[model samples]
Target: MRALALYGAATTLGSLVLTALTAAPAGGAAAPAASAFPSFQGAPEAHGTELAAGRALAAGVKFGKCPASEELPAPIQCGTVKVPLDYAAPHGRQIELTVSRLKASGKDPKTKKPVARQGALLYNPGGPGASSMYFPLVSGMPEWKKIASAYDLVGYSPRGVARSAPLSCMDPKDFTAAPTQSPIHPSDSYKKERIARAKTYAQGCARKAGAALRHYHSLNNVRDLDVLRAALGERKLNFMGASYGTYFGAVYATLFPSHVRRMVFDSAVNPDPGQIWYRNNLDQSAAFESRWEDFRTWVAKHHKTYGLGDTAEAVQHSYAKVRAELSHKPAGGKVGPGQLQGAYLQAGYYDDVWAMRATALSQYLKGNPKPLIEQAAPRPEAAKDEENGNAVYTAVECNDAPWPTDFETWDRDNSRLAERAPFETWDNAWMNLPCAYWSAPRQQPVDVRAARGALPPTLILAAERDAATPYKGAQELQKRLPGAALVTEKDAGTHGIGGGANACVNRHMEAYLLTGKTPVRRAACAPHQEPNPVSLDRHALPKRIPAAV
Candidate 1:
């Protein structure tokens, strides 16, 4: 959310690859213009060609035929409308962001309205890059469907994300660097080269993306949402966004509060232009260190169960030894720096996977790191064919907010932070290094200040010490957004706030979405109950909650 935190699980997930681990960022997706300007009544005559093309393409977002199509599966009935490359200048180069809806699979039509079509309940997952394309099926978030039973569940892919014209930079494996200590203090030539490499990646994106990249920022995404509202014929927009999506929703709330209906920003992002993504990533390094200690302390207490080490410091040595060994000769044929970095990255997201990570590392230290080794994202053999789910990861991050292009600036800060925060300082530095060479023309991030004009006040969910989007960030946004109630998990290590089996939080969310009943006053949303393996497997079946919009 702060930078790019993906909420979805991957396709070929390991059996031990717990859902609790934070998902790596994914960035990519694009869009095009709509029929004329305001096609609220129906698809415009001027855009007849696009309408036809959309229908043929099975975009699944049929706006002209709204109420009736409300009964159709999003992919089947909705028209995949296109919008401008730049909203301020509608005729600019454009891209397509897929929009779909599971129409209220109910008997009633909004034509029963003075209320005007229960509007639409839109959803977005985090990863300044993640697409809500799959939100219709995110197990714990049936709130989309629940509210959709009356309204429609509109899911959209952010710019250059899934099913859209995604931002293609380097392959995913390239981002997955070797897990060596990306220490800050590199020699003069090494520092210069890394900075140069960052510049090159940025320049490559500028070349490849061209003018189109300039318009792909979040402000554009918010404008696109307005276009979506117009296309849907909905006077107001109802949205539920998580993680980075929350930031998206918050920006929209500030931009178009009058048009927003029943908005819920769970696991928020606030684009503070003053807040550098790189420096914030440094903060994440500290948070991850705490979680690392949590794991070490737990492992030490249960020495027999884990047998990894007796003390946190000892485990640290073991970890360093394994890292050193892997550096000289990877455990399996391929597990190297990237694999270790990735596995460790997983630990930074949530505490639920701490034991599993420990187990993997412990086993690896004990000579059986096959499971952990496999965790490393495989290197791509072909450059062009190597596009990964993480392409969007770069797209959103590098473009969402502006970063200083001067390589020397990064080098100085990165060097200073590396001494104590070695685990992720360098890894994070390289992960974001591409931004220095981002293809898009830099745009200033929106201030994302709260609106003085209030909408239907909603609940804000945040973890106290969320690594990716620090809990304080949530409070910052809360301070900005007037008329919003704050719910904090006292000591949040939970990135998504109310995740896993967090009943107290989920109940409030469910109640809020189901009956528009939020916590009457302030309340301490409880911590996520420890995951019950049995309960989770059973929940593997898609969960649905009707959205009685």
Candidate 2:
């Protein structure tokens, strides 16, 4: 599993991941006094014998040297780090985080022995629930040769993610049985059903996860990350976080500014303290609508090849007709409006899938449904695995802040939004519905402001048309973190903008990692290429499209 650019969207990983809540309140709840969570009291870095004990405990865990495998581009070691389940009680019960590393590719040629490596570079791909243990495999690819050779590329499955103590909201059967939150209509019946299902999912997580659910928020994860820094013997942390990972990095930078070395937050989440999980999703809906128009325009330009239409409006009409037909009769008995949307949403994320998806839609319009059916095909065990991703996503987001408890509030807001941004409005609302009934007590969102010169210079990257984490977030992050530099991928819709296809952005990233200098002024990088129409092979739709990089 390459870095896959984990983010807020569960399906951002394509069919490999599950659906995450689309929207929820950004309001914070009162923090409980005398909790196990870290308080960021006193100086920036922690001291005393308690941290020493946590580090000593972490050091005792075992890791084996890695061997080459099909799943990875290079050999790497896999290990586990143990941290207290509740950071307030460091001596209490503990959980493990699975970590992986591709030791720096440094060798002394004369002696043909491994050379001493620079400090570790920890990376998070951002699902809050996404498995990051294998990210080093992707991050260490040829594109990152310079950085990979200089530092130990480290990754981990955060607590309650894959290979760790994972969270699950429901049994596999019940999980699969749950309907998607796609808006079938603006009817009260649909709203009621959606709320009822959200309740069922929330209650299931409480019944299954019990006390462990309360510890799955972001603050504890940040605490565990600090302990890892100590265990790895690094006085400072060097981190690269994308999407939701940016939020993690932001909190870490705020609480332990003195302990940060060099950090990069690409497609940063807004750390406005007032814009936590909910407002962010609404922003995403608007962004997606804008990007979707771009996709529609691209398809129209290739109408002679796709046979959809000669204009964007015509293309939309043709697509609507197919969607209406799907609503009446699902393709292969599975590709309903929800499944059709799941297949098409990738177009909003990246231009790479536009041609293929358009071809599928064209074929469906021409009285063939096989392409649509294949697009919605189920992955083996995606049901069970998706539950795990969704469960953890909900726990982290719902516990991070207080959500609006009234059903009327949710219904009114989503109803108003759906009129303009119908694509993902309701779908996102239901995705986040579990928060309304979340059992865990909430803590206030961290106000991420660092004193001037408190931390080293940092770099933030954003794509102008990114739908998930929009470009405004990058600007906000730059404004909040004094001396921070911002990089924009002009007109690009891709969520994760650096180190995949953009050499210019990569150069900036490498410079910041190898040397501590960040640009003094904002910068922009051009998109590599606009999507082109695929060959007009109507019968050959791809089995699957990889998630946007």
Candidate 3:
């Protein structure tokens, strides 16, 4: 996906490609001791030997059973970690999160004169809903290689997302979470009913989730990490969180500050704790709409390439006509207004992607079914198919704080805002409506104001253009945290400062993780200074899949 800007807020990908990598974590007691910096204790990077060894290890394992080592992604090595639904009361009930990992490659168990072996580095590709376990051992994010050289890469299904205690509402239909029926245009009464419906949705989740719902909060996931840390016997944690994961990373640091070793939070999340998640989503909605206009304008200017329109207004009208049409009778066979809208929502996440999908829509405007048909089909499954991260996201997000019981507030707030942020008003509402009736009692989001304690010195990353996690949020976090340094990217059109190809960001992050060096003085990273993107040779655009097929 072309990043909308150098910095972006993490949102759900339309359908990110998932490919296989190192086998799932295999058993064999974790190597007992941590290694010194620059010490290569693992096998060197031998694509052939390590690939062979990894396959051999994978071939022998039974599925659904995770070994103690959180460092391989073989089908046999991963199973589940049963954890209490709620962290406040850990002894009561339990839910399971499927976890996976890539063992340090290049390690020769025999000579022990390791080729490369760094500490464990856990990663998350943000989505309050995206799964981390599915991130290719080598994702588009470049830092994976720096950390991957010696350390184990850990990934897991968070709670209430795709796999871990998956939050299934209305079968697959609800996955779109848009209006089931075409929504009536907003009116005072329409707004009122919308509020009522939202309340009902929240209540329904509460009823369905029962006691287990309480366990799904950011703190609990942190607790889960504590458990995993103990289970893996890692003395401290190293983490790389993008988008929603950034917020998750922050929560973890706040709750268990001492346990942190090194972390990179990219495309940052606003962790103010007071702002509602839906409200945050609203900000993203507004940003996306603005970007969409830019896209329309760009397309209009390049009518020959796109054939959408020769003027911005014409292109906007073209897109609006589709919106209006979908608002009434959806196009194609099965996609409804909500699905179309949700797909539009999916379309706007990255700048690079919007144009391609927009072009696809442009082709659709000509009455070709290919674009619309592609939009209606299910996305390709991840090569190493693991559960997506919906459960983990909801588990932690729902528990992090409480929502207003008054549905009127929700309706009043969203309806009024939707008028201005038409692109994502109700869509964002439904994306979060489940919280209204969340089954568990809402735990107050942690009031985390970081104080420089003995926790490891950390690096904070922010992209000035990031809308999902706004640069201000990252700035605020950097200001509050102790022993932390901040890095910013200016005039860039992608999210996540340290990820992707920017060498400026990569070099600093590399030095930090590889040598325990935090950016002592804050610096700026721009696209020109960025490293070449991963797979620059394979310039496939971001893939946008149907909301639900």
| Tens-digit lDDT string for candidate 1 (26-132) | 11111222322233234232233223223222332444332352343324334466776654444445567676665554432234332223556777766666666
What lDDT score is found at residue 344 in candidate 2? 74
Model 3 lDDT per residue over 1-549, tens place: 111111000121111101011223334323222111112133221121222222222333223545553344453246456555543333345566676666666544445455556556777666655555644345323455545556776677776755567764323333333323335245667555655665665565556566666656665555666555534435567887877777767877875575688887776666777764655665665666654565566567677777778887788777676666655665554455555554555444444445555656676678774665465433333211211233334445556677765666777776777677676566566545556666566666666556757467888776565545666777877766777788887755355546454667777777888788977758887753322112222246332110110
Model 3 worst lDDT window (10 residues)? 1-10
lDDT of each: 0.57, 0.71, 0.55
Clash number for every model? 46, 5, 62
* Cα RMSD, model 2: 9.8
Which is the better candidate, 1 or 2, if ranked by lDDT?
2
- Count residue pairs with overlapping backbones in model 3: 62
The lDDT, on a scale of 0 to 1, for candidate 3 is: 0.55
Q: What is the TM-score of each candidate against the true structure?
A: 0.77, 0.86, 0.75
lDDT-better candidate, 2 vs 3: 2
- lDDT, candidate 2, 453-543, per-residue tens: 9878999988888887878888988888888999888878777766766777878887888887777868888876775687445344222
lDDT-based ranking, best first?
A: 2, 1, 3
lDDT of the structure predicted as candidate 2:
0.71
* Whole-model alpha-carbon lDDT for candidate 1: 0.57
